[model samples]
Target chain A: MSVDLEKLLRPVDTPLPPYPPKVITLADGSKMVVRQIGRDDIPDLLPHVEALIHHERDYYDIVSVRVYAELLAYYRYRVVDEYVLIGQINGELSAIVNGRIYSPEIGMSYHTLGLKRGLRIGAHCFAAKMEYHIDVLKQEEVLIVAESPIGFRRWMIEYNLEKKFEIPHELGGSPSYSLTREIFNRARGSLIVGSRPVPQDLLDEAMEKILPPSDPPKAPPDFLAATRAKYDSTGTSIIADPKRKKVSHA
Target chain B: MREVYIVGIGITSFGRLEYPLVEIASYPSVVALQDAGLDTVDHLFVANMGGGRINHQTALSSAVLDHLSLWPAGSETIENGPASGSSAVKLGFQAIASGMCETVLVAGAERMSEVNQLDATDFVATLTHPMAEQIYGITLPALAGMFTRLYMEKYGVTRRHLAMVAVKNHGNAMDNFFAHVHTRVTLEGILDDRDAETNNPVIADPLHFFDMCPVSDGGAAVVLASKEVAKKLGKPMIRIAGVGQATDTHAVHERPDPTELTAVRLAAKRAFEMAKIEPKDVNVAELHDAFTILEIAESEEVGFFKKGEGHLALERGETQLTGKIPINPSGGLKAKGHPVGATGVAQVHEIVLQLRGQAEKRQVKDPKIGFTCNFGGFGNNVVCTVIKKEE
Candidate 1:
């Protein structure tokens, strides 16, 4: 008789309720369907997140790298009680948000990555994540942290999240912030959006496939553009490369 | 006076540009010089605001002149609140038409993005009256909000009218590559939909988020020359037919009628008189739509419509790209991105593009006459220019 070691190495995940899908009408009058995805769909989401790992603006590289790792860990049964949600606009993946249940009364917030840049797709998805933990799962609070200034503004400042400094977030050693039920309730009307009972056709379209994002953030064509934006009071960098043909006037 | 013509024009993308302020002003100068096939100008006028406070750089004209390598040319910086861009253009015209200079280059630029939003807002708020307005913590949006409410009460201009202006300008900006806002907003999305409240929150009372122009960093330049120089260039003959400026009481409460933009009316009247044309003769226009309500108010004040009926024309789609006397075919300041200093010159640039028939997709139908209204300090100071294309 031989003893099996594979079963003992993996941590068993606690059963959790599924997040109901909802639809949001974007500022451009387009429909976005947000729904929960299972572990099997993680592979389908990695390529898009992986592509953003090289983008240098707004800390997209760090956030995308962590999101890719989180997706991989969830897929390989390395993490327990994890949930993934995606937002799709016309069958195209627009954003990805994920988290994990720490206990019956607590949740651990992970990441919110918006594939589409300007239309506030990430803000809506992050709202959906908060809704999942507090409204759906009935947790008391969700511990959150932001890796970018955009995320900080959306989560900490917008929601007025309370400091959970004593508790360190899993992403890093930084002190965590807690989005208590009281805070979520206070910021509910303005920050939270989207309607329930999504129409069948729209839901079916989002479920059919997770197409690539139409226009995702990318590396700046001219590296000096970023350099000049951050520092460079001398103005010599631009003058030295006048004929570079990358002024971005258009 | 001799005729002053715009021989060349150029602009940069109106958004978050990550370059030095002088470089921002210099790039467009280079483009305009290349367009006109000129190596230098007799003089240069740079329009800028917030250079000292926001960017920690002053003497912008000296820096830009040196940066462009145009040493011998005289340079000056003009500051007139939001009207700085057009004021520079006006001075450039005066220099050429008065025979003080044969050629002048007018460049305007702003880099508001270098600072945070609150700081930028405060920087702009400094434009208000110090003793009367600033003491009360009044900002531009607050002033616009009060003006919009009065316009609504007196003129029956509803939120729907404002949304229409935003929708129209946003749609027009999609075709403008250099515009700041490329997102297309719908009536349903911004006003009618359930998510509208969240998507378009109230920034100032009665003025929604979309009703105001964005804080942008951009640059624009125009080369003004005498008629003889214009003839030799072989470019489109876009002559600056008229330039008129007028001022009003600095404090808003001092105005005879709070609802009226008297300076706009006076400036437009003088511009039309000097040009020997009426409002109806204008083929296209670019009004200073820093706030959506201003578009309606200025349209009426400039004699495009009855004092209280600009909204009616908007309802009739008379201000659309295909409508009669199409307004802001270059998206106006609402969507084109208002870089305070660059805005006035940018308006002239669009008018020149229209007169030259070079506005690719948003070009008006054979426009021969173009009008621009550059408003400053809540209409206390305004500059109006009328341009014509000669055969």
Candidate 2:
């Protein structure tokens, strides 16, 4: 536990340019602010991410667990050159995206976790992360991988990212895909979008505090409804719960 | 023919259900039977589209009948693409009217979520002319895109009009508990905003993401009985006053005018004629809106509005829940979630709900007569039905 041993254990962090804040209007006319968060802010976002570690649908469980670890590592100085960006709508956490600088010319995308569903919150935050690497930091390309099919469709197919199969990504050692500057430029106008210098009020609200998601994804009333239905054949498992009536927006 | 009344109805939540196809179909039948206070029906008709292809199951009616413990009751499976639900209902009507059965249970179910979106789209695309359309990679959306371009050029339907249909339906769906998409979207966000392009991305040119219906998994059932049987049941009688079906050229390009949904027109005309009521007399309607454009187009074709003026009526708010015609109070397929086979039956279920004054939040104003247009295969096949409540 000597100071020299502690110094040897912690990786040296690189100084990267800060990501400028931007605002995007979602499908429901809510404004979302995408801004980079320092390690100090990681605590406020951890509980929300941990809550989704057992979400059990749409690959949210795996993605949230990994993102939780990544955020924790960045907070504890366990990861090198990592930066976390969060999206907040009405000061509530809607999405989280994180990545790190791999080299002077390359970037590594860790994960994009959308706490809110159906409004493309994840997509906007993801574009901001890419913009951070290519537009701000001036990286040539970013290495990315998707843990969910929805992520794959949004990033790999939507951007037409090139394969970097030889390089295993840090998450799961999956084969990586490279989103070059050319690809980002091609998708800028249509896919990647946001207005820079976010409105003062919106930016201030986002920076105020990370509120709990008003309508987070919920575990089903019965986790094993399908399996139970298979065995019971009475179709009782599919019955509607008397208490839980409405599905909240994602 | 005799009078055939829909004595009881039930439907599953139209979304990504996590049960077997038989259970999906049978659950509604059980509910319908309970609603009718009947232990059995003389026959069961199951309507399903993708059972064999997606679920790897065949003889769906047999399985559903056995699952529901309606043993020895004659059962049959019906498939007519998206029109399968109404087709099965039409056959049930025929059986009751022809005195072949005292009562008939018709249930339509589709578990399209068993496969991914691409595979489900491909399976639905198989309804197209295989040699001409399917071979050329023609999905329903692709055909709809081409048709939309022609409709836009010919009738001046714009993207704004399409978005209006989506907005109206989604708003209507907010009140429908069974609707797949409960998310409320605004014109400012989906159309006019700087991020509208990404918020409502184009699935097909002239047709954005909101313009198309979500693929769903669900079931719906209606118990059709003879007038005598219906009277004995002591439930509100919603008679299937008319049923008409028509088919057009299999290949969309083969039609003389790709913009015209001639089958919808013909089928609706015949249904209205048989119902002894003009389109104006119908209190409410559930038009097929697999795509938002179809709502506008089918509205005109079904005689709710003049051709080329549907959008104008839409502009005037004529098809809203409180408007002149009040279309798709259950959000149609656009927001209700189209489980292909379940769509037609679900349409009937909605109409029945409206006629019985059971639709709570999204109910129309004292609807006495309700109509449904169940479109199949890019308007190649269509089934139209009219239902009226007996006073």
Candidate 3:
């Protein structure tokens, strides 16, 4: 028989418990169903991720590109032990979060992308991922890294994650931060929100179709706007008049 | 004194603006001048609070004058805390009415987002008594929270009543393209839902996250000129009929009646006397709702409703856009975003928009008289203005 190259190319996934689906009552009083999705649903999610690759604000471009690649790898069986979860508001995609099992005691955090932002949709999804690894899968720690300032504030600072400087992460070569079980447990009550056994109709609707995000983040209309912002080198005035050339540094 | 009319009004969107502080001030100046069909003014007054401390710029009016390319005219910066916007307009009114200037441009701006939220809060807290309040870490939210508690106890105002104020203003903002907060909040979202606790946390107990006005970056301007100058422009005659300002205790605790906004009552009385009109004559108003409670308290203090009955009037659908007396047709500070220095002028700008019959989607029916109360320093310094649209 010819050598089985396909078997060598695909890594075998370890059997893991499925993440229980939950529903969160959003600030708008609307119920959002957060549930795990299998590889078969990757085709429906790819277009949304691809659409956000060109968005230049708040690091969405970088995060969405990597997410697209990760989901594609998971679909093709090139990667092992991967999971995906999405927050859907009224059957519309509001946020997407994903991660993978590195080992029995360690977890790899991938990305958290909130399509409908300003309501902390990303923060809620991120909390669910940590819950999945620590509470559901019984992992000791989850390796995390923030690709955007918003993410850094939400995950690292909010949760007070520990820096595992020596351990390099898969997404970026930089050292990964560790969200230990202790840290996850401390933030669970307040940050971690959602109820088990998402209602039948809501679950059925979320799985039936993945609708496009109603409100998506957009790139700033003008980069010159940021350039015009005065940079206070020494707390001095950044918008001093040209005639006043002797303006002191902040 | 001669009659002073506002012939032009202009404003930038009240939100996180990316332009420089001076540009934020000058952008509205250019628009106001264009609206009035004038290229120059006899004087320019720029209203700002933290140009030096927050934006690291000083002598703002001079910088703004130069930035707008309007040199040689006299200019000065007016800093009166959050009331700076109306204080600048009051000065402009005096300049035009006293014949010191035939035309004047008053522009107010604040770029609060330059600093982080903590810094902005601290910068605003500086308005409180340094020794009495600041040393104890008393932010505006804390002060509003205490005031809300007392008001709730005495007036039977529930959290639902406050949420109603927020819901109304947010609904009003949905139609205002220049407003900062476009989010539509419902009573269930902030109050009834189980996630309401997390969604709208108690920022300072008794007042939730939705209760306070957002710190914003924006600019607003009004062109005040003599009646003759106004007639030459052929625009609607929205005269600055009256401008009244009053002061109260610097420390909120020092007042005998903590619930009473004395400055608001006195200033409104003075404005009404000057304008020869009662509160009932006003068809529309823009109250300083830096906190949702302020709208209820101020409405009563200004005689819009009997004391302790403002919330009831709100419940009666009286403050809506199509109600008997529409309040905050421009969304007020709650949803419109309070760029502190620009807020008072923005309030007056909305009144002008109403009097000119140009407040498109949220326009009140034939609003010939409009009112604005710009509260500053937690009611310590208050300015009230009455505007009339002449036939």
Q: Pick by DockQ: which candidate is best?
A: 1
Error of 2 at B69 (Å): 0.7
In angstroms, give how far residue B199 of model 3 lies from its true place.
0.9
Best-to-worst lDDT order: 1, 2, 3
Candidate that beats the other on DockQ, 2 or 3, i.e. the better one: 2
Number of the candidate with higher TM-score, 2 or 3: 2
- lDDT by residue for model 2 (B254-332), tens: 9898888899999999998889899999999999999989999999999999998899999999999999999999988
User: What order do candidates take by DockQ, descending?
Assistant: 1, 2, 3
TM-score, structure 3 vs. true: 0.91
Best prediction by lDDT: 1
| lDDT (CA) per prediction | 0.90, 0.89, 0.88
TM-score of chain B of each: 0.99, 0.99, 0.99
TM-scores for all candidates: the values are 0.94, 0.95, 0.91
lDDT over C-alpha atoms for residue B40 of model 3: 70
Q: List the residue pairs that clash in candidate 1.
A: none
Q: Tell the DockQ for candidate 1.
A: 0.35
As for candidate 2, its clashing pairs are A117-A250
Model 2 chain A worst lDDT window (10 residues): A241-250
Error of 3 at A135 (Å): 2.8
